[model samples]
Target: MLVDNHCHLDFPDFAAELDAIVARARAAGVSRMVTISTYVRRFATYRAIAERYHGVFCTVGTHPHQAAEEPDVTAEELVELSRHPRCIAIGEAGLDYHYDRSPRDMQQAVFRTHIAAARATGLPLVIHARAADDDMIAILREEMEKGTFGAVLHCFSSGPELARAGLDLGLYVSFSGILTFKRSEDLRAIAADVPLDRLLVETDAPYLAPVPHRGQRNEPAYVAHTAAVLAEVKGVSPAAIARVTTENFERLFAKAVAAEAEAGAA
Candidate 1:
């Protein structure tokens, strides 16, 4: 089965037909999805979505863009919220200098909080690095020295340098619909170089739809297209990519997988 390692089912865009969207994903072989949290204040919305769908999981953290708005976020707060059985990861948090949506220092501060939470809880952090790759890499490197944390560079669009930094630091790299773009040859090259165990695929739904669906809203169901392209780039069948990446997902998010395994065993 396929899995959209990351998505935002809690967003307003899918509110009207959330059920149908999830159903479509199941039909497309997407067995599970992680509905990402962008704002800590509305984490309940994400929790509700995860509760309603067995195949859906969720993360708890603030996005970089919302840093200023969530200035009081603390590592302890994220760790506390992550106690929920449905919360499998610590963040969609990191640097995003591309938009300057929040002050750079604020973004860095919030990102550090997320790193701390991930380290404390032993959960994988869902990272989002944008144009400020150098700063992002620098912070990640410094943080690694302080204490290592499990993390994945979600929807990676940064240059080779950043990808190398992430890989060297022992963070997994996830590809999105962006890999299907014709001009993403360089991205594909980078994808090719990522170790098999460290590779992942995501749709980043309601955004960055693949080539055939470019400029349109994306969904977890479309992760297959991205996976197909990734398989092509890696010179393997789509099914191989599916199996390996799904295994990688389970390995990285150990607590979630262990819970699911126990349930099945029972």
Candidate 2:
């Protein structure tokens, strides 16, 4: 089974058909998914989705782009929200200078808040870094020195240095549909060198749809294509990639793992 470690199923793109979307994902071998939150103020909506779906889990935090709007979301607030069992991860938060929708300083502030929540709650942080590797590395190192926490660099497209930095800090690196893009040879090369146990796969879907599905809106079902491409890059079968990433997802999201065990035991 595969787990989409990151996606935004609550977005307007999936407004009318979560049923069909989730069904498609299951049929394509994605048995689990984490519907990420873009704003903590809307966490009830996120929690509702998770509660209604058997295999879906969620995170609670504001994205970096909206850092300006939710500037005061505290680590205490995040930790409290995370007490919900289905809220299995801490954020899709980090730096995104590509759009600069929020000021870099504000983004850094929000990112630090998320890191603190992760540290406090012992949940893995879902990091989203773009176009700000230097600052991202500097901040991650800064926070990491204070205390260690679990994390994954979601949809990684950064320089080799940043990738290495994340790995050095014991953070996992996840590949997305971007890895299957026509000009992503460089990314594939980077993917090849990463330690197998530290590599994960995702479909930051409704966004970067992989090849063959490149022109259309993406969904979790398309994670298969990205995984296959990743397998080719790593010179293993897709089933191997699926097994490893699923294990990695469970390892990082310990709450989800425990919940699954409780359900089965029930």
Best by lDDT: 2
> In model 1, which regions exceed 4 Å deviation?
none
Candidate 2 residue pairs that clash: none
Residue-pair clashes per candidate: 0, 0
- The sequence of per-residue lDDT tens digits that candidate 2 reaches over residues 50-85 is 998888999999999999999999999999999998
Local distance difference test, per candidate? Answer: 0.92, 0.94
Per-residue lDDT of candidate 1, residues 74-99 (tens digit): 99999999998889999889989899
Q: Work out candidate 2's RMSD over C-alphas.
A: 0.7
* Model 1, global lDDT: 0.92
TM-scores vs. true structure, each candidate? 0.98, 0.99
Clashing pairs in 1: none
